[model samples]
Each structure stands twice: as structure tokens, then as C-alpha cells.
Target: MAEPRVSGDVKAAFALLITLAALTSLLGVGALGWVVAPICIVLGIYCVLRAPLRSTMLTLMFFALTLENPSEMPAAGQWQSPFYMVGALLLTHFKTVIGGPWFFGGMDLMLAAAGVHWFVKLRGRSRGIPTPKPMIKLAHLCYATIAFTFVIGKLNGGGDSSMAVWQIDRVMYLPAVFLLCQAAFTQPKDYMSVGKVILVAATIRALISMYVRAIVPATVDPISGESDLPYTTTHHDSMLFGAAVVLIVALIIQRTGPKALRLAVLLLPILFGGMVANDRRMVWVQIILVFAALYLITEPNAFKRKLQRFALFMVPVGVAYVAVGWNQKGGAFKPVQIIRSAVDSDSDESTAWRDLENFNLIYTIRTKPLVGIGYGHGFWEVWPLPQVDYILERFIPHNSILGIWCYGGYVGFTGLTLLWVAGVYFGVRAYHHCKEPYDKAAALVSFGTILIYYVQCFGDLGLGTFTGVFLIAPSLAIACKLAVKSGAWPSALRPRQTA
Candidate 1:
């Protein structure tokens, strides 16, 4: 042996331990526990030896544990997040059956190890380059705004606990977004990697949605607990719609670009699979708007050329649609009932009520006007009974503006609104000015996709969830990059001149 090559030794050790653990576990308890314990010990050792693999393994373990027993995973719905709540409290308060007490001690150790690794990497790479001062300032500003709102809510009283809750929810998103922004700023290639990751994640999510729609009966099981599981008319549709929009832009860019068509081609089936899952509004709108943005932003001559080619391609698609007309009843292309119900929405009472609720929320935001009622405070609570009727269960105000009103109040709201205005200004300018066609296409598609979220938020609180926050951050970072590339902002903080 070559004096125990580090990589080879680690790989061999990992494989051997994993194999022994699996085999021993299959035989059952006593030996199984012993075998697995050694493997975990080895894993801890190798994790330090192989940082990337360790991080990946840790993430995988987290997801696996969550999916296997979602109910048990740290959550406010029942038991709190394992580390922060139970571990920090109960485990610390009393001795345990296994090991030295302290509930969250192991978690703290893992987190500390991860933090050390992260700082080491950061220090190693930040050789002579200046720290990202402007980005850091913006990050601090966002953090301050959140802290200020929280402090204010605390000072105000317990009467507005709901508002405080909403504000607290938004604070969770900053870290994830900041991490993504850091990745984009330091390694733009990472953004593209994230794009591919989204495609992979979306594919799995689409498949899950398809299974849920086609296999799982809609019947509610009383024994399983709860009266009814919430049904989403456009549940599986978001990923499909977003992917389709991306695909269309990808196809259009391919017309004149020196770029790979593989991503778009690869993603098409995933989009179709999503479409088959039956939710449509968000997806369909995303597709339309992305192309529309592309058309709007490109130079007139280039756009005309692209449009002509698109029209030529669509002729064949149109001809096929006409030829097949309603003949494929049970085929993959069959009409979806969800689509029909969605389109024929004028008379639906549920649709009317949902829309009305959304409208009322918007109107209430107008009442508080500036600063609104304080971050996460009023709007939704006042929503079901705007006239102070019995408080219905507080909900996520479907609209983003309403959410801002409920959570951020005036000061936080002002900061966010300025960000939006700046985002739009830069986004349009970036699309028009970027030198690389693929980069331009990516920017425009991202801008349009994000814009769709703006529209979708008019009747949904899509941004409140952590998943939604992750989705939004990348789009914002891309927009920011595009803005910088386009020179929409002056080299200084001053506004750009209009010719």
C-alpha cells in the first residue's frame, strides 16, 4: 500500500464501517447497536477528515430524518425544533438515560465543528481581496430592521402576539438569503449550480405531487386525525410552471446563442410531468411572463428574429394540437379538471370569497397607510373581522404587501418597498445591457419568474414559508447581479442619469 493514501484509507474505512453496520443491523439488536455505534464513531472521525463529505452526509441525515418522521422533527406545531427547544430546555434541565446529560450538547458540538470548518475555509480564501463592504452594509441594514421591529413588538405588549410571530417568521429568512447572496458574490458559478439543483429538487417534488394526485384518494381518514387535509388546486403546479417558463426562455435563447441546450431539454420532461400533476395557474403564468419579459427586454431587431423563429416552431405545435383535438382523452395531454375549474372561475363562491378576503386585506393595509400597524401585527388578525368581530384563526395574509404590513409596519415596510423599486429598475436595465446572451436570458427569465411571484402573492402568502424564502432570495441576488452588470446604479449611491 502507498503508505495508506489518505483518500483511499478514508474511503475504505467508510465502506467497511457502513457495510458492517448494515449487515449487523439486519441480524438484529445487540450486535446491531454495537456495529452501528462503531460506524457512527468512524463517521465522526472521517467527517473531520473529509469536510465536504461530512457536510453532505450531515445534510442527508437531516433530510432523511425529517422525511421519515416529519411529525417528530423540531416544529412549533407540536414539539419545538429539537435543538433550540427540547434540547436547550429539558435535556439541560435534567440528566438523561444515555451519555452525559445536556440535551442539546451533541448538537452544539456538531454546530461548533461545522462553524470552525466554515471559518477556516473563509479565512483561507479571503487572501488579499477587500471584504464586500456594500453587501455587508445592506446585510446589516436588513438585520437591524428586523431587530428593531422585534424590539418594538416586545415593547408594545402581549396584545399583539400574532404580529410579533409574523415578524419573527421573516427574521428566519435572512440567514438563508444572505448565505445564497454570499455564494453568488464569491462564486457566480455557484448560482448556476443552484439552478441545476433546483431542477433536480423540482423533479422529485413533481413526482411526489403526481403520486399524491393520482394515487392518494381525496378521502379524509378520521382515524389518522384531523377533519380534512388541505387540498391545493394548483398544488403541484408551481414547480411545473416555473420550470416551463425557464424552458421557454432557454429555448428562445438557444435560437442565436453559442450555449448549451441540454438544461432546457433535460428540464422539459420534468415540466411536462408537473403539468400532468394538474395544478396550472402559477406554472402557466410563469411561462407566459418569462417569455414576455424576454421579448420586452431584448433589442428590437434581435427580439424580432427570436419571435419569428418562435412562431415557426409553434406552427408545428399548433398543427399537432389541431390534428389531435380532443382525441387524446386519457392521454398525457388530456384536459385537466383543475384547469377547467380554474378558468371558469367567475361564478365560484369559494373563488369569490378568497378574492374578497385578499381585497379586504389590501384595503386594511391602506388604512394603516404609512408604517402600517407594526410588523406582523394587525392586518390578518383584523382580516376575518375587519369590524372587530370575533377573531377568527389568524392566517397568513395571502398578499405580500399585507404580510409586510402585518410584520414590518412602516419602517420595515419602507425599506422593503425601496428594495422592490430598486429591484425593478435594475432588472429592466440589466436585461437591456448585459453583454452575454445567456447571462441576459438568465437575468430576464429570473426577473420575470420573480415578477410572477409578486402577482401570485396578491392572493397567497407564498413568501412566508422557508421554502418560499429560499426561492425568492436567489431571484433577488440574480437581479442584483444583473443590475450591477447593467450599470443601472451609479458607481456611487447616487441615482443613474437618464438620457
Candidate 2:
């Protein structure tokens, strides 16, 4: 067959995009001058010429941005600050895609790209822009509502300005990533490629955590307290690492690649060891829940066999943990010590504090009920005034669901619950609709990962950070797209061009 001709309209639009990029670069030259201008021009040209490479480049950038640690790389911060890492990575990627020095950052550019793509695709179609599926629409609505409520609360002097901005990003910008990803992941192969990127990123993180714990133990030490082995950053980064572990195992169970499987098995000790060293009870629970969910979702009939296989897998892992713990000053690896910490409800300071926080949340909810004191207001009510600064700075919430209830009231709480319900529904539908075993397995794995994070959100802010949103949103988008493509849902909601 002859190569399909590029459309005239597409060529024209691309030309316009390039011109705008050039203008932006020219404007920046006045401010940034000679050195930055030439590099931007070259990168912009490369991006236009290598348009197909955009996805892979963005994936790699995502990995680098996630792995960046400002505390550890203060020197690098002078050149590129951690706060702007995501923005910088995104701007560079967008500069290539749009063919100029686009200043928009993070998910904004992606969302705008998706919108433009949709509009272009709709140009000659009878149907207008197709409404997204109900669940997807509801998710967008929830994020928008929460964002609006947060801003209003902030205007009312309910929370600190910086924290309000962070919360707005978490609620709105992060979930918007799903729409951007949906625009790119149009084919099964594309979805698989994204999965591979995630696996590679996770594996790198696992390896780095192992190396850090060994070489710079103090660097990995628990921010909450000292530990023998360096622990992964708690709440945020640790949960992210745990999510990666879950994804890796899910992909392996799906049998993504025999070679990759062998490598992953080799790295399992390091991955699991990092999880153990992280010393977060919630992460440990997340790991267990993910495995159990994966088994039940993917192989419901072979429970006994799966249990045997898992037990065999644990043997080497347990042995490695013991071996590592043997040399440490404290028996951080000792089963007894770990178990004591997990179960010590009355004595463990963290546990006691969480219990108190939970009580305070409950009390506040009962008092305010419908529209609880806005987003950050609960912190002041729940904790002492002196500790409010520390608590607000960390954005720590013992129970995320309750925290939402405290922040946006029942309306926000219900919206979030429905979103998860919709996620689980679509995830199951994806599995049912997929004809290929691998696709089915991928669907299950993605769903299971989201489920793990959803469950974690009940007790921790696992689903409230950029890392958590990035991991879950793309997977959710993949599953939903599969569901639409496989005819599990009506095609009415899928963009006509996408269908």
C-alpha cells in the first residue's frame, strides 16, 4: 500500500505551531540571551522533525522528575530546583512537541495538547467532541469541584496560600494527566509501551534505593526516626516505591516478557528489601493487599497453587532480609521487631498520634457534618497551634478520606468515593473485554495497582500526591480506553476520532 498522505490541515496547523514556537524562543532570547537561545532553537527543530519520539521522551522525563531528590542533590538545585523539576521537564518536552519555547508546565500543556488534538480530529466529523464516559466525566467534575472549593476556602482564609495551591494541583492538575495520557495511548501497543516505561522507572527507583541504603544509610534513614537500614521517604516517596513494586509484580504475573521477567526476579530482592527498609507499616500492608488482589483478580481458580508459588518466592526474600539485618546495629530486619512495631497500638508513638488524629477528625466531622471547616482549616482545629505549622508543612493526614470529609464536606467525600467505584467498575470491564491474555493481565495489573492506592488512601495520602496520581491516572485511563475499544461500553462517549 502507498504511504498515507499527511493531511493538508495537519500540515498547516503544524506550521502554525512551529511559527508560535519560534516567536516564543525569539522573545526569550531578549531575557535569557545567546547561550539559551541557540539550544532552544535546536531542540525545537529536533522536536518537530522527531514528532513520533515525543511519548518516549516525555516518559523518560517523567522518570527523572520523579526520582529527583532536592535534599540529596542541593548542588543540582542551583541549576535546576526540585520544586520546578516537573515544570522544567515538562517545558522541555513541550518545547519539542509544539516546536518552540512553550512556557506552560506540568499537566497544563498536556491537557491543552489533548484539547487541540480533539478539536482538530473533530473538524470534519458529524459528531462534536464526544462526551467522556460518565465515570471519567464525574472524575473531572470532582477534581474541579474540589479545586474550586479549595480556592474559596483559601480566599476565606481557611488555609495557607502555598498549601492551597498544592492541594489544587493534587486534585485537579494531576487527574487531568489521565486525559492527556488517553490522547497518546490510542493503541494496545502504545499502552504496552507506557507499561514498559513504568516498569523501567520503577526498577531504576528500586535499584537506587538499594544503593542509597547501602552507601548513604543516613540519607535513607526514616525522616520520622532513626533506623538501622536507610528507609525510603515515608508517606509520599515510599508509597510511590510500593506502588512500583505492585506494578512490577502485576506485569510479571501477566508475563510481559520472559527476559524482563528474569531480570525482575533478579531484582525482586532489592525491590522487596527496599520496601522492608522503608519501615512504613502502611506500605507493607499495601504490598500484601496488592498481591492478594492480583491473585484473586487474575487467577481465582488456582489459589492453592498460587499460595505455594508465593511461599517459594518469599523464601529467598526472607533469607535476604535476615542476612542484611544480621549486620545492622539494630535488628531492623528482625521479624519480631517489625511485628512489634506494627502491632504496638498503645506504645508506638506514630500509632498513638495517628489514633489521636483519627479521633480529632471524627470529632470535627461530627461537629461540622455537611460542609466541614474548609481544606486546611481542620489542621488548626485538630492539632495544637504550635504544631499546625509542622503539620501543614508536611501535608500529613492520618486518614485521607476523613481529611477530604473535613475539607470539602460530604459532597467532596461522595465525589471521591464515586470516582473510585467508577475506576473499579471500568477496570473489571477492561479485563472482561480483552481478548488477549496479556492484555487481560495488563488490565488486571493496572486495576490492582489503582485498587491498592485507593485502599491506601483510606489511611494515608497515598492517592493525594503527584506521584500517586501519576501512577494511578494513566493506568485508569488505559483500562477505560480498553473498555471502550472492546465494546464493553457504548461508543457514544469515546471521541469519534479515537473510536
Candidate 3:
């Protein structure tokens, strides 16, 4: 028999194992510092080289584990494994290292090297099919907008330069966007598989956040300004509150199974913990939107059936909320105050509204309707009033859209509107083609979450955080995947859809 060839990927895996093992022995894991630090470094690298979907799944699991127990890994070395120790310190401060600069930077390095290697391997062969035209166009538009902002800033000379850097970082949205482009050219089923990875990662992140927010104890630093943790407290409140919204939408859309209830039960502590954190405003707002949207999305018959089922489901939750109303210092769902706080024109809750000394966003819109300021600039700078200065007090704008307007001016504002409209249009089309119930449900979860984020942006910088990045990236990837699967992207280009 002829000798069989070992695949390139298998060879790569073998090489990775050998490298890790050698590093372990050389570093000497007999000491506590040596044991886990190298292990984590190897795992982090492993996550980058694996399939994007698989790597994300592992990343989520790691995040959950770390959040649940900050001290789960052995302490990093005082000297030897400095990279690992530095990563640990960063993780401790930010509460997420997997999605932070280290992970991305490492991946970028590996990808650049691998891409060159692959190019050499295919030196005489044709290049892999280029990404789809439409997807490429969208990516180009995004990239162009980012470049345009920087150029405009330079041309103007001494405009908010920091805002230019922030807009450039917005290019981080590109990786996930390119992933969607890949999805457009690949099999549709792989999209769901990829989506499942994202959801699982989110679930893992949520579970870990539950522990952090509910059970973990942490301290706030007065001087350097950071969370000091003997790991005493976690930022559970938002995680739980957000989880609740994710849960209800998941159930309604039927994405998660019985696990939804189980997760909800597990998440109770997080919900309570979030309330204690005093970040109740967004949580309460999210909850109301979840229920309201749920009510709107269902048909008459299903709505009636769901109403009965919901009542049953609400029994325990309602009772708990009622009983623990004040006692659950860690809970959300303050009906009256939530609405009042969110809409209160004079309070910090209404940052832009109060800052501008205006009661309505509509009024502010009338003042600078076309371009607005730019991404971080908002109306406050152009006007430069005492109240605006007092409210933000040397801070960025709370409203994401307003910030775009302030920084980018009319041109950037137009680009933003188009970007969001494109997102919604394609996202809805993706929702329509989803065949599986769970897939549909997950799509709905994304839909509702995006809606909440978009609405929240009017009052807060909702889409500005890494949380927003996680939410939008997966949603867009899933959308592109769905479109490709439905034969909407072109049969020759589309791969078969799978669950």
C-alpha cells in the first residue's frame, strides 16, 4: 500500500503540542507560578489557530471559568513567565483578557504569519476564491468611513484627535465583518455552527458573569481607580439583568431549550447583584423592552397561548420580585423609577438631555440635524455651556449617535445612518430565512438585543463598549450566514445550511 500523507493541519497541531510541552519542561512547572501560566499561554494560542467558531467556543469557556473563580489559575511567575503574568494582571483589571488586546494581537500575528505560509504553499495554484463582492463592498465602505474620519481630522488640524483614534479602533468591527464575508462564500450550515459557537460563548460569558456579579467580592480603588479583588464581589447586576432579557427572548424565539429555565434559576444571584451595583438603569430598561417586544412579536393565537404560559412562568419570578423587592438589593425591575430615571430630563440618567439643558432629543436634533458633531463629540462641545461641562465634566458623550455626529460631522452622520440601516435590512432578511426554531429564536434574541442597544444609544453610549462589539459582531455574522444559506447570496457562492 502507498504511504498516506499527513494533513497540514494535523502537522500543525502536532507542532503546537511539541512546542507547548517543550516550553512546559523548560519553564519547570514544579512551582505554582510555572504550572498554570504556560498552560494558559498555550491555550490562548490554541484558541487563535483553531477554526474561528471553535476558538470562540473555547474562549467563552475560559472567560466563564475565570469569572467564576478569579484565582482558578496558579499565580503567574514573578519573573520567568512575565507575558503570562502581565496577561493575568490585565485580566484582573479589565475582567476580560480573552477578548482584550493580547488575544487579538496574538491572533493578528499568527494570521499574518499563516497567511504568508499559505501563500507560499499555493505559490503556483490559484488563490482561494476571493470574498464575495457585496460583502467586500460593505467592508470597503466601513474602512473608507474610518479613513475618511482620520483624514478629515488631519485636514481640520486640532479637531478632537482622540475621537479620530476611537473611530479607527471601530475598524475592529472589520474582523467579524470579514468573517461574515467568509460565511457568504461558504456553506450555510456552517453559519449556524459558527453562530452556535458565538451563542455558547455568550452563555459561558453569562454564566461566569453570574458568579462575578452575584458571588464574587471585589474592591474599588480610590487612588489608581480599579476594582480591587480578593475576588470578593462581581459585577453581576447587568449580567443577570441582561441574561434575563436574553432568556425571555430566547424562550419566545425558542433558541435555548429547558436550559433557559435552568440558566434563569442560576442567574438570579446575578440579577440581584446587578441591582446592588447601582447600574439598574440599563437593566430595568432592557427588561421592559424584552417583554414589550415579546408581546409585539407574537401573533394573536400564539400571543394568547404565550400569555397563559408566561403567567405560569412569571409566578415564581413575580413572587420572588415581590417578596424580595427591597431585600433583593441585587435585583432590577423597579418599574416606575426605571422609566422615570431613564427619561428624566434633568438627571445624569439623561446625560445629553440634561447636558444640553433641553428636555427632548428632538429639540437637539433640530439644532444640528444634518451632520451633528462626530462619534465622541456630540452637541455639548459646539455649544460649550456650563451645564454640558458640569454634566460630563471632561468626559465623552453618552449618546453613541450623537458622538458620531459630533466627531464625524454631517458626512460621518450620514455614514452611520446607512450602516445601521444596512444592518437592520440584512438582519431582518436573515431572520425571515431561519428554518430551525432555536436558530430563529437566537436571531430574535439578537434582534431584540440590537434594538435595545440602538434605543439605549439615544440616552447612553450603548453601542460603544466591547459588550456592544460582542452583540453586533455575532448578529451580523449570523445574518450573513443566513442569507448565504437561504441561497440568497447566490447558489454557486452559498454553502448548504445546517443547524
**Best model per lDDT:** 2
The predictions' CA RMSDs to the true structure, in order, are: 9.3, 7.6, 8.9
lDDT (CA) per prediction = 0.47, 0.56, 0.46
Order of models, best lDDT first = 2, 1, 3
Per model, state how many residue pairs clash: 12, 1, 32
| Runs in model 2 lying further than 4 Å from the true structure | 1-61, 69-132, 151-163, 217-235, 251-260, 276-280, 303-343, 380-398, 490-499
How does each model score on TM-score?
0.63, 0.70, 0.61
lDDT string, candidate 2, 145-196, tens digits:
6765676566656666656655554466445566555544555545566666
187-297 in candidate 1: lDDT tens per residue? 333335445545565665555545545554555557743213232223323633574347355536635342345655666666567555544455665556666766666
Query: What stretches of model 1 exceed 4 Å from their correct place?
Result: 1-135, 151-157, 160-163, 183-185, 218-244, 254-266, 278-280, 302-346, 380-395, 417-429, 479-499
Index of the highest-TM-score prediction: 2
Q: Looking at candidate 1, what is the lDDT of residue 244?
A: 38
Model 3 misplaced stretches (Cα beyond 4 Å): 1-135, 158-163, 171-244, 255-278, 297-300, 304-333, 346-395, 487-499
